[model samples]
Target: MTIRMAQESDIPELAQLYQETVLAIAPHYYSDEQTHSWASFAADGVRFREFILSGTTFVATDETGILGFAGIADDGHITSAYVRRDRIHQGIGSTLMQTLLDYAKNHRIERLYAEASEFSLGLFKKYGFHVYDTEIVERQGVEFKRYLVERGVIKKD
Candidate 1:
């Protein structure tokens, strides 16, 4: 797979990947109705497309389609990072994250932070992000507990 800068046309697939990831992991952290509502908001075309078209958005793709995506804003704050459900544990998140980190470094950003869900905490940690704090993020009447992970000006070549 390759991690490349996202295009406007890729927004739909990118949003779909994100929604799938959230839905796949929601059972571990939210009630069914909450999960549904949360996922519904995530599928919002306008919002998701805006995110994908923002500061720095990247996608990991193969011949089939998008497998994962990550978006960074305000220099290095990771706004989103999600891999397709069935494609998890296959290093796609790592690849996409590494790409974002590199983008940050190239942009002279001194550090990067990500508000990551429990399902993705380990992946962030694996990539050298340390937990800065924990907070409850709410959307559409659903609450998602996550870690704020920050890595200071780090990127692997």
Candidate 2:
């Protein structure tokens, strides 16, 4: 597998996989309405384009298509990271994270954080991140719990 910088052309597929991830994973913790409510149907193209075009985005791929991706904010926050939901548990997320963490270290970032959904809680923990706290938010009478996790450990590339 090869993890490479994401190009603007990769945005559409990334968005599609993100939708698939949201749709497939949300229901494990939320209601159907809540899941669909949180998702957009017409394709949220602008945000994806902006993210890929902005500063730092990485895509994991093999002979097939995009298997996973991670993005880091300019300020050292881990903005987004997701593996194809079905293709997870094969260590793609960890690899993606290590790659981003290496980038952060090279750039002299001290800490990185991400709002981890329930599906990702354990993975973050495996990477030595500890949850500072959890936030519960209600939307349309449905409640969601998200973990605020941070890790300051740096790894050399």
Candidate 3:
């Protein structure tokens, strides 16, 4: 697999991946209503495309197609991170995150933050992120329990 910056052309595939990941994995932590509402965001083509294009988004892909994607905003907040349902546990998400972190470090970002799901919290923790807060986020009338995770910059010699 390869990791690269995402482009406008990747919007459709990214949306599909986001929807699939939310539907398949969110059930482990969220209720059916919450997962459905969250996944529905991916169906908004205009909004989804705009969001992807507005940040430093990266994709992990190969000959088969998109394996995963992650993105960070200008302010050092991770906007999204999703791995295709079938490809989870294969290092796709971690690779995509590392790619984003590398880009952030190159750009002189000092820290990174993300509103992480219960499942994603562990992944962020593996990379040195710690929860600073717990919040109830709502989307389409459904509520989600999420954590605000942050990691400071890791200076390289």
- Give the number of colliding residue pairs in candidate 1: 0
List TM-score per model, in order.
0.89, 0.87, 0.96
lDDT ranking, best first: 3, 2, 1
| Candidate 2: C-alpha lDDT | 0.82
Best by TM-score: 3
- Error in Å for residue 116 of model 1: 1.0
TM-score of 1: 0.89
lDDT by residue for model 3 over 1-157, one digit each (tens)? 9888898889998998899899999898888898899999999998999879898888899999999888999889999888999999999888988887887888778889999997788789988899999999778888888999998886654
lDDT of each: 0.81, 0.82, 0.88
Model 1, position 152: C-alpha lDDT score = 88
In candidate 3, where is summed lDDT lowest over 10 consecutive residues?
Answer: 148-157
Q: Give stretches of model 1 more than 4 Å off.
A: 155-157
lDDT of 1 by residue, 58-154 (tens): 8888998888888899667898888899988888888888787778877878888888777778888988899989998777766777788999875
Order the numbered candidates by TM-score, best leading: 3, 1, 2
